[model samples]
Target: MGIVINQSIKNTVITYIGFAIGAVNSLYMYPHFLGEDFYGITTYILSSANVLFPLMAFGIHNTLIKFFSEYKTEKEKKQFLGFVLLLPLLIILPIFAISILGYDSIASFLSRKNAIVYDYVWQIPIIALCMGYFEIFYAWVKVHMQSVYGNFLKEIGLRILISIFLLSVYFQIITVEQFITATMFAYLISMLLMLFYANKVKPISFRFKIPNNAKAILVYSSFIILSGSVANMLLDIDKTMLNQYIEIKNLSYYSVAIFIATVIAVPSRSMHQITYPITAKLMIENKYDELNDLYKKSSITLQIVGGLVLVGILVNINQVYHLLPKNYSGGILVVFLIGISKYFDLILGNNNAIIFNSKYYRAILFLGLLLAFFAITLNMIFIPKYGINGAAIATLISITLYSIAKLLFVVLKMKLYPFTVNNIYALLIGLLCFFGFYYWEFPFHPIINIILKSILITLLYVFLSFKANLSEDINSVIIKTLKIIRMN
Candidate 1:
């Protein structure tokens, strides 16, 4: 818990900084500098790459995290690491070959509706490969219980680099085309840096011999690739489907709303960085009590923290949109819909780690595939009719259903539940803050209004949450901060 708190706080700060930079790029720079069309193009390409990377990595990143603790000897660990490192190439190389052999057909199909996508079709795989390898190295560090640097590179470094590229576009130092290329290069650079750090953390011995448990490893990896693909699809498929059904600029608008909503999930993302490996270790050791403790603590802690973020965003959503261009304002509903789903996801806590590391993973994988199909079907039925709003509807439905299913599976199968009385308290507090502050806007500029309102929301929310003792971990931190301030 100490390590989790230490690293999660650092990672949370880093993730928020990244999101701040991303907000500027998505809300201001890209829309204002590159125009909506190219911004849409950039968003579509990145989304497509995100959906593809999980497949290219062949799920080895997650496989490494799940199995790394099982090996006893350093030799055995090296053998496993070496196997994990090269295994993705088996899928990546073939995909690259197919991409080369079938570029025309692939590009033509992808660009059937938006011809601009054809020119960037090649960038998707390139960027996906970079993304795939980066995750592999990130998992490498996580297994060693050193996630902060990787989190920095992932959450802060990449966004900073991309911000530079966006600035290049703004000053006319680079054309939008060049900026797209720079975006690809940015991912490549981040991947290489992670690879360097991973090696420094644990110098690679490159023992390529297959471990004795090759069959189990392969089985797990197979399920994980499907699960990871389904999860990524659920996330990025909206933007991808939007490219096919609606004008590309709508994706830019939807992306802005999505980005604003994504900030609510930062705590989950940050905590998961450390909790995942810890959960893996606990499960591998068969420490059910500690595992359940972690499960509940993680849930309430995230619910308290993420619930505040959700309320803040919802209460000030209008001011957020007001700062954006008129065309981008259409995604206000999109933000609300996606924001709720993300908050639901955050409350699930370490549910994903529990299921994925458990033997019952195959069931969840099958459920995820069904949900992925459900998501795609929903998009097909809705996107054409509702446009960006339709995509948000599809995403909201798919994600909410998927989240509920996963939660039920863990509760019923593992007989472990993440909810407790604290969750109920947190929910009530969140609801109160939302309704209390939502209609009351300060008479000032949008930025000033948002700042004042957010401050008020944070003060009231934190004060009540602290008094109620909703989370021991959070209350402990608050007490420590107060003591330090008093001393200073």
Candidate 2:
């Protein structure tokens, strides 16, 4: 538990730092330097890469984490890791071959909606392939319980480099075309760095031996590829589909709002790195009581922190949009809709880890595929009418449904629930702070108004959280924080 909380704290800080860097890139550098159309292209290419990478990786990243513990013997572990490492090549080569063979028609099919995309469409697979290897190495570190360095690379390194490139564009050091190409390859650099880090953490067992259970593992990896693709699709497909239906510039606007909203999910993302393998180990050992305890604690702690972020975003949304260019202001509703859906997911802590690592993981393929289809269908119906806002609505509906199904499956089938009585109190706090401060204003600059409102809201929320003792884990941290500050 100590390591879990400690590492989670470290990763949370690292993730927020990354988000802060991303905030600058999205809100200022990209808009001010790249302009809306170019920023739209930037977002489109990256989002496309993200959506495609899962299939290219063939879910070996997930397979590595799920099956790592099953092999207790050193030799089995080495062979298993060896097998996982090489499995993605089987998928990647075929996809690359197909893309090259059908390059003309494929480019034409995608470009008809927005011709700008055609020029850079080829970057998607390259970036996605890089990302696929990056995730594989990242999982390699995760099973070793060393996710901080990987998290830093993931959350901070990439964004910081992007910031530098955006500045290069601002200074006329490079053309937009060169900048885009450089940006796509930056991920390749990051992935290579992780390969070194993984090897350093534990020198790779480069043995080419196949494990005895190779067939079973390959089947699982296939299920995981579909599962992983659908998961990424749920997160990323809306932006790609938008390219098919609207002017590309709208994606830049949508990307900004989604960026602001995604900050709420950082805690879950950070905590999951360490907790995932822990959950897997517990399930393997049949430690149901301890697993349930971890589940509830994680849910409350994440929701408490995530709820605070959500409220802060909601209250300050007006000012945030004001800070952005006028053209980017239309997706305020996108922020809220996406934020709410992520919150529901945040409350279901470790639910995904539990399900993906359990025997019922195959069931996820069916459910995830259904939701992915539903999301794309809803986008098809909604984007023609609603544009970016419609995409958000489509996402909101699809993700909410997807999350609800996962939560129910975990509870009904596994009999493990993450909600606590304090869950209601935490929600009430967020809602009260949101409504109370959202309408309040100051006769000052927007920055000053944001600072003042945020301080007041945070203070009131923290005071109430402490006084009410909403979570023992959080309360303990608060106590320790105060003691450290006062030198007690």
Candidate 3:
């Protein structure tokens, strides 16, 4: 429990640092230096690459985490790592070849009427392959219980590189096309750094000895690819599908709004990365009581933190968008819908990690895949009529249904629930803060309005949270931080 809490805190810190860098790049530099269309192009390419990488990697990364603990000997662990590291090439190489061979057809299918998606399309596979192996190496390090450095490289290191690219754009050192091209190179460098760090953590021997559980690993990876694909569809399909029905520029605007909304999910993402393997180990050891306790605490802690972020964003969304170009403000609806969806996901806490680690993971994943398909269908139907707002509506509806389904499964099948009296108090306080700020008008500048609203909301939530004990983990950290400050 102590280790989990400590690692979660470390990862959360790293995620925030990354988020700070990302916010600057997204909210300031990108909007200031690049047009909305170019900004959208940048987001679209990256999102597309992310969606493709999981398929290209064939879920070998997840396979590493799930099976590496089964190896009892050092030699066996190294061999397993080597196998998974090389396994991605078997999938990536052929996919890259096919994409190259069918480049024209693929481009025609994916590009908007006047858009030249092909000119920049080659970078997609290159970036995806680079990202795919990075995950493989990162997971290899994670199974060794060396997650902090890997988390730094993943969450912080990648963003630092992106920040550099944004700075280059701001200085007119790179054209928009050149900056987009440079993205693939940045990912490649990050992946290489991850490999170096993985080697430093545990030197990879190129041994090809097959593990006894190799077959099981293969089966798990196969199933996880389906799961990964579905998750990707749920997350990225709106942006991708919007390109088909709407103008590329509009897709770009929607992407920016979604980016803002996604910041709400950062806490959940950071905690999940640290807790996944731990959850798997607990389930393997038949520690149901510990698992349930961890689930409840994680839910409460993440909800309070995530809810705070959501409130902060919603309260000052107008001010934040006012800083961007006027054209980008059309995405207000997108922000609301996606924000709610992300908040719901955060509220569900470790439902995903629990399900993924459970014995019934495949069935849970299948149900999720079905829900994701429903989301895609909704996007297809709504995006043409409502544009970005329609995509948001689809996302909110799909994720809401998905969350409800997962919660019911946990309750009926596993008899697990992640709610308590504190959660209700947290929700009520969050609502009060949001509504209080929502209707108020201050005679301050936009920037001051944002700062003032954030401060007020923070004080309100913190006061209420301490009174209700909504988050003991964060409360303890705050106490320790205050003591340090006073001593200083």
Question: Top TM-score: which candidate number?
Answer: 1
Q: Candidate 1: misplaced stretches above 4 Å?
A: none
When 2 and 3 are scored with TM-score, the better candidate is 2
Task: For each candidate, give its TM-score against the true structure.
Answer: 0.99, 0.98, 0.96
Error of 1 at 51 (Å): 0.7
Two-way lDDT contest, 1 vs 2, winner? 1
Query: What is the Cα-based TM-score of model 2?
Result: 0.98
Candidate 1, 1-488: lDDT as tens digits? 99999999999998898888888888899899888888999999999999999988989989999999999888888889998888888789999999999999999998898888888889999999999999999999999999999999998899999899988887889999889899999999999999999999998777689899999999999899999999999999999989888888888898899999999999999999999999999999999899999999999999999999999999999998889889888999998999999999999999999999999999899899999999999999999898998989999999999999999999999988799998999999999999999999888999999999999999999999999999999999999999999999
| Model 3 misplaced regions, further than 4 Å | none
Clashes of 3: 0
Give the TM-score ranking, best first.
1, 2, 3
- Residue-level error in angstroms, candidate 2, position 219: 1.5
Worst 10 residues of 1 by lDDT: 202-211
TM-score of 1: 0.99
lDDT of 3 by residue, 72-177 (tens): 8998888887777667777787988899899988887888553756587778888888888888888877777778887888788888888888889878898877
Ranking of all candidate structures by their lDDT, best first: 1, 2, 3
